[model samples]
Target: MSLALVLDLFGTFFFAVSGSLLAARRQFDIVGSLFLGSVAGLGGGVIRDLVLGQVPSAFDRPVYLIPPLAAALVVFFLLGSVERFRRLLLVFDAGGLALFCITGTVKALEAGMNPAASALLGVTTAVGGGLLRDVVANREPQLFNRRDLYAVPAMLGAGLVTVLWHAGMFGTAAALGVAAVVFGLRVLSLHYGWHIPRAAGTWHGSRRE
Candidate 1:
């Protein structure tokens, strides 16, 4: 019933939607759609929990896994109606990204990790699912090269949470504020075509060999 848990659940729902949208777009079967949705919803948290030496809640908690799989099923049954809202799913993914980062950091702190380590784990929790999604989808992860400020925003938010926690400002307000900043950065980057610097003289993806 805590606000953090609320955000986490909401994040799971939206990210699941995003995954379901992708699966539909790719014409994946029902099983594949469900697999992607579950991965997008719970993959990051699972990695984070494993790293912290805790049992992943999604493994036993139906609440964490149900929403995503249900979403996938919804999309499977109602493809035409759902596909129109595909664009909105990216926004949902961004929200999920921000929530997961903050929640991950907070959870790491609760698990006795130092601020720095907690922040790093936060980034891991925020992006692990997306990475897995892309890999399983047989596409390159979007975080590679200079693909807009994705992971960097997660890092920034995590860093902010660490600093605020260290400064005795650890509270719901602080966490929400930091998450908003990260989410805003991601939105602005998408709007303005902002991108990080890539390696010198390196081509992304392919060079048309």
Candidate 2:
């Protein structure tokens, strides 16, 4: 398999794990966990592929379905052990975000998209899955959370990928380096409570009857 395929699969697994953990925490049934895991693993890629006018890999390729199922089973069976690690879901999410940004940009570039557009799509791919997972689980999306640094890190990683591709310096090592940097930035943001500034003052509307 190609390095790009490997990266895509790894991202899928990471995101699926995060989704599965969330489902476990929510006390979802195994079927529900699997469903959420699949959505989280494949949603972004599906969106990306659709935007590119291609069939979604999760449907076109059977291999793409394995990661989410495996993740669901793992989380369901290992709930206790997995729960011992604090913020484990966020860690996995960071890993997925880092890799998807790179792969998404690369795919868009390969499809003849301009660097600017490709970078934007990369950010979309990085965040789409988590956003869907949150909505499906009936939780607020981290992307819209004022105090979260989710999309910014994705944008940074996507921009870097675009730059490297334009410079003709994109390779396995460069890809890994960019992923590592993105992951570190996300983890650090979580640890330090970093976020972009929001509009000053909260909105207060008239109280509802």
What TM-score fits each model? 0.88, 0.95
Candidate 1 has an lDDT of: 0.82
lDDT of 1 by residue, 89-198 (tens): 66767887898898899889888899889999999988887777777887667667375678988999889888888789978888789879988998888878898765
The residue-by-residue lDDT of candidate 2 on 1-209, one tens digit each, is 99899999999999999999889889999999999998899999999999999999999999999999999989988888879999999999999999999999999999999999999999999999999999999989978887679999899999999999999999999999999999999999999999886655335543332
- The pairs that clash in candidate 2 are none
After best superposition, candidate 2 residue 68: deviation in angstroms?
0.3
- Please identify model 2 stretches exceeding 4 Å from their true place: 201-209
Q: What lDDT would each prediction earn against the true structure?
A: 0.82, 0.92
Best by lDDT: 2
